[model samples]
Target: MYAPQEDTELLAGALVEEPVPPGADVLDVGTGSGALAVTAARRGSRVTAVDVSWRAVCATRLNALRAGVPVRVRQGNLFDPVRGRSFDLILANPPYVPAPDGRGRPRGAARAWDAGGDGRLVLDRICREAPALLRPGGVVLLVQSALSGPEQTLGRLRTAGMKAAVTRRRRIAFGPVLRDREVWLRERGLLPAADNEEELVVVRAELPV
Candidate 1:
């Protein structure tokens, strides 16, 4: 399982900036390590965290317990475990690194980062499904490398009738994953040669009340 990294920290920072009402219903999608989920629960939101990996689900439950907060953890694909439920707030830090070639979803640890070409695999699905899970006046927060098209994410969420925008952005040196994929990323025109800095952006989409 992928550990908490730059994208995770960026999203967590955005969560701090968002105004979540006390005892709000919160859903955390792909809650790897449970960092964000625990924080939300600590802030008094009733939390449900979900991950596709059993390992991650287990980790989240353990972390929430250690944090002395109650978090309902589940194992399932994004949004599936919480079907028919609407949330006051939602958060995600999905895998979004662009894969090198036509390798249908890498089967190992790389599955946490190797998204299909254009890196829209999980991002697109999140944009499509998350809006429905949000209650009116509720917001969804997503963090991703700028390589995966934050503008496109904004467009997709806006099309779904939410006011969507990049709420937070951080430019940091490429991590090991990006450093390793630099050549292929350049070849795909996703990154420029000699450009070592990548921007991570937090997208916020809020439905009107």
Candidate 2:
């Protein structure tokens, strides 16, 4: 299972700035460590978190338990587990690394960051589907790597008729995964040869009420 990292904390920090009504419905997609779900529940919102990995699902439940917050955890891809349900808030920190191949499905821990060649495998899908899963006036806050194309994400969400913008950004040195893929990323023109840091961004999109 993926542990909470910089992107996780960045997304959670942005979540704190959002005005969540008491008992508001919240969905956390790709909830790795259940941190976001637990945070939402602690704010008195009803939370449901979904992960494609069974291990992640178990981890979320365990973390929620330790945090003394109630979180409904489910194992499924993206929106499958919450079909027909609309929520006041949706949170996501999906895999957005630009993999060398980016064709086949990623396995094991790689699932936490491997995306297609352009790093939008899961990001694009979230943009397309999140709008439908959001209640009118609800918001979806997603964190992604700058290399994965945050502008593309913003444009996609805007095209979906939602108000979308980048709310927060941070630059951090390359982590293990990115470090390992640096050569490939540079060759693909996704990373600068001289740069060792990447910009992480929280893109927030709101549905019209």
Candidate 3:
């Protein structure tokens, strides 16, 4: 089975080093395999992980148990399951793949990987809704792709009235999504004649008091 990737691990480690107040409540949006939620719980945060996929929710629960941490895993879209709920910290590794057609997402798509066209569908919603779900002085951690550009994500957060910054970044090898595309393009003679490397952009943004 396809499992949680290294970017998830990197995002978890980044959250561990951030200033999370003791016993802070944390929400892990799009907790695909629950890696980040488990890490936050193990670090003493009260964590709730939300995913739209039943499989993801189950995976998160099992992963949390394996990690010996208690995390509430919920199944719902975005913040729907936790409406009226606010948290001290929110972490999300949302789907941000920009589709080639330049159109919106299709129905019943993979919530963890498909980001619709321009790869900003999920990121955009998170930015717009996060402020309403965050406590004063809360912080949000987001890990997306450079395909959508770092500034674009930051701009959304700023427009949402949150102070945002890029705290950490590391180049990651292109995963299956990009790999398949590269193969298709090569077969069609559309790929560049030279070597190419794809990278992911992991960013952390905070909401000020």
How much lDDT does each candidate structure score? 0.91, 0.94, 0.80
Cα lDDT of model 2 by residue, 130-203, tens digit: 99988899999999999999999999999999999999999998899998989999998999888889999999
lDDT by residue (1-209, candidate 3, tens digit) is 12677668768778989888768999999888888898888889999999888888899999998888999999999899999999999999888765556344644545567676567888888888988899999988888766666798898889888888887777767777777666654554434446475556667777777
Tell me the tens digit of each residue's lDDT in model 1 across 115-194. Answer: 79988899999999998988999999999988999999999999999999988889998888888989889988999776
Q: Rank the candidates by lDDT, best first.
A: 2, 1, 3
Candidate that would win on lDDT? 2
Q: In model 2, what lDDT does residue 59 have?
A: 92
Q: Model 2 segments beyond 4 Å from truth?
A: none
Q: Score candidate 2 by lDDT.
A: 0.94
**TM-score of each candidate?**
0.97, 0.98, 0.88
lDDT of 1 at 17: 79
